[model samples]
Target: MSSPVRYAYYSIAASVLTLGLKFGAWTLTGSVGLLSDATESLVNLAAGMLALWALLVAVQPADDGHAYGHGKAEYFSSGAEGVLIIVAAGGIVWAAVGRFLDPQPLDRLGLGLVMALAASAVNWFTARGMLRAARRYDSITLEADARHLMTDVWTSAGLVAGLAVLLVAPPSWAVLDPIIAVVMAANIVVTGVGLVRRSLGGLMDKALPEDEMRAIHEAIRAVAGQGALYHGLRTRKSGPRRFVDFHLLVPGATSVARAHTLCDAVELSIVSRLPGTLVTIHVEPEEEPASFDGHAVGGACAGGGDCGSCPGAAD
Candidate 1:
């Protein structure tokens, strides 16, 4: 088993532990806010399992059927987690509304708060560790799990603080329980929507971030040195991997071996700058008018001396 998959196991174990604590707290106190926290923990458990599966699939080597590898599996895990979170949020809102309609007196506030605090501590430590691992491995599944765990920690803390206020206030403020749950639900919905959007962007092959794109350009320029131009630059990311494609224009008199060597230097530079990056360079003779025919972004232009239609113009 890989290190990242082991982190997923830790996440699952933490989820189970936190879920037990939070659920016990909710049962003892009958606080809707605690109930919401417990519900999100349930979602966390499901997400961790899904993330484990995704990591397993994502780490698989490329095969004949999947020439690009299985990296996109991580996106499916995150997207499903997002959907589960939204569904859990809906359940929370429903429970909160019912609680608001028929208020109930909370019990064993001291014990319930202690349990919630304990659960939050577990999640805090687990999330911190998973976050570090996620950064080290560049695993989206681990990052999503870590971020969701952090959200649960914050939610539990907020619930504890709200219920503590109830311990000192009048019974009329019991409505605050449901109010806090509703607020927690809203926050979860926002997180869910954001995750879903990011997943869709990944599935849609969204371009690499500007900083990485700039790095690619800089690498090419440094390696190609003088009397060279490049265009039709494109880039995208899949899980931990990055893909970069561009056309490198060298002098027409340059030999094929020299052009090939230039391409190798450019690829090495880019990979050094951005690890896990796969660069594909199309070598073209600078003096040939046909070399500028097919630009990736805006297609061919009528007058093609780096016109507005060319992506290189903007670069």
Candidate 2:
């Protein structure tokens, strides 16, 4: 698989290209809407730089001080990008408000529209590639960057369409320039907030998605065999890596070698189902009353009763 840093570099390159194109458009036409588009491309440039740094940090191997690895560094990159996006939106709104109070005639709008369209085309292709890489690598940082680029593309498209309307309408319709800028700002704010929320969730060590959890359960249950049970299943993800820990219950008469073999099998099954997963299994004899003590995810089952009542039974 290609490293995320490669894709991050792709984003940075695209941002630089689009940023120049957009600023050129803004300069040519003196349109607030075009200025708003340029502002977002500036944010994209900063965000891409941050993503590159974060991806470099996140790839570092686990050290003595950080046993879990530096994967959570990715969350910081995405969160910081989100903040930059919102700040850029605020700047756009401020510019739009100024233009609203004192409207100005747009100059050379036809050439400006052409430049904006070219920038949007570059962003559209770059975002698509980044999005595909994100899905393949399960990298949140890449996904955030790609989404922001796509937002910029849409914003540019909207501004182009609105400016086109102004070109044909009366000079009185010049107010649409600021109005379109405000609308574009609102559209990007939504994307910014979404990225912020997702980044926060990742930093908080949120559980894996439902489908991944279901796959884990299926893997465990397949290796558990008849009469054996499991409990206290817990899961979390850090960047592209998933972590799972659980308790496996079996008859007291099961030999130590057999238990070790079963634990190995269960771990293999889970790792197969979800690549890049780290699994820890605690083996406990089912006859032990203390084994059923629920501490994390699964419910406790009192000793000498049917294990079917345990929360893990359903899983």
Candidate 3:
């Protein structure tokens, strides 16, 4: 399996183990906060499994049906994970409200809190590793999985705090447990919204960031040199790949083969500067002095009294 698939698989396994442990602790302690944390873990487990599947599907080679490949599967997986997080938050709110209605007497608060803390620590490490892998590989699925794990860590920490407060504080503070659970649920909902936004952007083929576009422009100019002009730059992301397409204007007299060579050279230069990027260049012959500056025109030629076919000819 690819690195992304391996990372996602391990993440899914860790989430499953975490869910089971947190649920068991909740059963023993009857802590509403722990229940909320467990619910989030359940969502994490489901999301991780789906992420693994998405990683697998995303790595598939481009087929006749999908010329751009199956990378967008990651976006669907991410959106699904976001929806699951929202659902988990709703469940958490319901559990917290139920606990407020009929508060359960929590037991072994210290032990349960310790267990939750341990689970949180595990998640912290797992999330860090997954995030590192995602950055190195530029894998969207792994990044989403990492975000889910980080959410688990935060929710687990919140649960630990709520339980600790409930144990030491006066009876009047018992409500803090449910209150913290609500807060944790709200936090999850906020994170879910962000994930959904990113997924939607990916699905919608949002343009590349301005900085990236500028970088491409610089790279093209560097390869084409001073005389050439470019426009109609566009870009999009597909899983780990960046698709960049742009138009380049060259002198009319430049041979087609040489222009093709120059285009290849520009692409190579850009690709060298950019990692995990695919570029397509469309060459357009310089028609007239559409936007040329004086320096672009080298000198007068024999035919038209001007090197109109030369760089900056109209200029």
Candidate 4:
């Protein structure tokens, strides 16, 4: 439905097409390196389909069972992709070790390299576009997809270079094919671990980055430019959405209508600046108990959904 989602669909198409091309190349040349590259493309096909499904679910409106919406589904998809990467790497290692034990001569050298490079070129362009879309939408699904494609591009490039060397290489150097495959696997292991780490952080509801957090603070200050007091500032990101909430301390003489108006203004400012952000403002009298002021303690501690140990935190 959205631009980012459209890109996801395109990714699926690219994965299917490339997988076919790479496998055909591997079959023709019998190059273990090309086989390794093609194997990774298969994983890409599966991951792309999963990402599409996750993005669809993530865009659904909040329902009774999911008050916060289904945005976290994207993290699950990302984590799955990470696991898939590791699995693919293991498969590559196993294949490489086998090939290393019994080196085999390759055929159709020139043709295979051409096919592989063509697939890589498609991925190169697709990955570049996906990276741009990911940043624009702040969608982890697209980011993971982009990272996967970029890794594929590099792996394909390495395989082509290694195969090209075999064209003039002595017969004794055939082992290099499998060894290079092992190296490619090692390189992808790092990518898998990084994706898994990012997915877990999202699942844990990581706080916004320092820059965006600063923006949230600035928006609050600008909307309450008259010096209204606030505390209990907190923020978290869920998929493409941001959540922020805080306490608004107003003078006791201020009428309810005026307090409501101020809260409305602050929420509008933040939503406008952050985009897709949800803000909650809890209004209270300036003279409220000390617990109110200490509740959040510099706006860092989560307060454990209670007053917490902060002396000024509300009960």
Candidate 5:
């Protein structure tokens, strides 16, 4: 397995442990807020397992069926996680509402608070590690998993606060517990929507960022020289890989071998500048001569012929 797969496995194990601890704590305390936290952990458990599967599939080499590779599986995995989070949030809201209508006597508030605080600390460290790994590898699935854990951290913290309020104040303040649960559910819903939006963009094959497109255009132009123009620039990202394809228009007389070499050089340069890039260059003949007036020109041959007095052409 690759490093990404290994990291995902560790994440899944950690999430499972967290789920068990949170559920146990909720059972002991009978706190609605702790139950909400536990429910989110259940979602995290599912998301983490899916992310591990995605990581494994994503790292697989491209085959005949998936010529562009299996990296896009990460997007699907993250999107599913987002949907699960929304569902978990809905469940939390329902539970909180029920508790509001029929408030339960929460016991061992101090113990519940301590357990939640410990869980929060564990989530904080684990989430940070997951995020750092995801950023380093540019793995969207891992990043999404980390975000789920981070949400758990916040919810757990909120649970602690609610428990504290309930313990210090009289029974009249029991409403605070359910209220905090509702607020946490609302936050989770927002995160779920954002994740789903990102997933849709990836699945739709949205164009790469403007800055990335511009950088690629510049890279191609740097090598193609005057009278050469690039078009049909398209780009998309999946997991950690960036897929780029474009058309490069060159002089009609340019040999196939030379054009292939130029494309190779440009691809290499781009890959060096940006990691995990797969480039495809389509060579097209320029139909019209390019103007040189007021624009800086490079490698333009005189007399409109090759092997002549070109400004930057090799002898």
Candidate 6:
């Protein structure tokens, strides 16, 4: 009933409808290109189902056994979808090669083309909606699904254009149909590889985008005060959640209560800028003699170099 779940359902329904339409087109015209398009839709349906389940799992509250929640499960779904896409492309290549060699004439061109167009239309609209929802909620699973659907729309468009050309071109150009199918396979291969790479990146705990990092910096700058410095700023994203950790250096003379207040203000500012962000600030007394970047420094550290007033300290 959540927006992501609803979008998943929409994806499943659309895939089913488009699958039927595309296969019908393939059956009517015996075009291998249409068959390949239908096969991708079939992959879409399976992936959409997987995405639905993943979304459900991801929504579950974190438990004692799994403190970070089940959001990473969505990445696995997308990775599997990417592998499935590659398999679909392989199937397409095999079918295309056979058709290219045999050179069979297509039939009922008009109806098949119309059906293909209808399927593309559905994909185009669904992809747009999914993308909007994904950005709004910061759900990578939905975003992956949207990207997959958009690829399908492009595949459908290429097939439609190729088939239309086949209808009027010379007999020598009949080979164009299978060739177009091969080209589409290549296109989807790139899409699949991209999805896989993104899946791995997410699973490996990639940092947040530059824009998000900039926002974090802005939030910190807004709350940071004189004699307060930050270091070891780190950020990572897992699905809709963000984790941020940094060391906050403050004047050692500052009271614990005041430091806590400052920490709260900075944390709240970051959370406001980035929803679902978990911030951890380690307060360090600037007056405390501590190591800075492996160098033993005096209490009064500007954070870049050693303290000036301490023995054996750098200028």
Question: RMSD in angstroms, candidate 5?
Answer: 7.6
Tens-digit lDDT track of model 1 for 52-105:
999999999999999888999999999999999999999999999999999998
Over 21-64, each residue of candidate 5 has an lDDT whose tens digit, in order, gives: 78878888898889989899888888988998999899999999
Candidate 2 Cα outliers beyond 4 Å, as residue runs: 226-228, 296-315
Clashes of each: 0, 0, 7, 6, 0, 0
**Candidate 3 segments whose C-alpha is farther than 4 A from its true place:** 288-315
Comparing 2 and 4 by lDDT, which wins? Answer: 2
Sorted by lDDT (best first), the order is 2, 4, 1, 6, 3, 5
lDDT of all predictions, in order shown?
0.86, 0.87, 0.81, 0.86, 0.79, 0.84
Clashing pairs in 2: none
Candidate 6 per-residue lDDT over residues 83-171, each given as its tens digit: 99999999999999998888888889889999999999999999999999999988888988999999999889878987898788777
- Model 2 RMSD in Å is 3.7
Superposition TM-score, candidate 3 onto the true structure: 0.89
C-alpha lDDT (0 to 100) for residue 256 of candidate 6: 92
lDDT of 4: 0.86
- List RMSD in Å for every model shown: 3.2, 3.7, 7.0, 3.2, 7.6, 4.4
- TM-score for all models, in order of appearance: 0.94, 0.92, 0.89, 0.90, 0.87, 0.90
Residue 156, candidate 1: Cα error in Å is: 1.2
Can you write out model 2's per-residue Cα lDDT over 110-212, one digit (the tens) per residue?
9999999999999999999999999998899999999999988888888899899978888889999999999998998899999899899899877777788
Kindly report which residue stretches of model 1 are placed more than 4 angstroms away from their true locations once superposed.
294-308, 311-315
Clashes of 4: 6
Which residue pairs collide, candidate 5? none
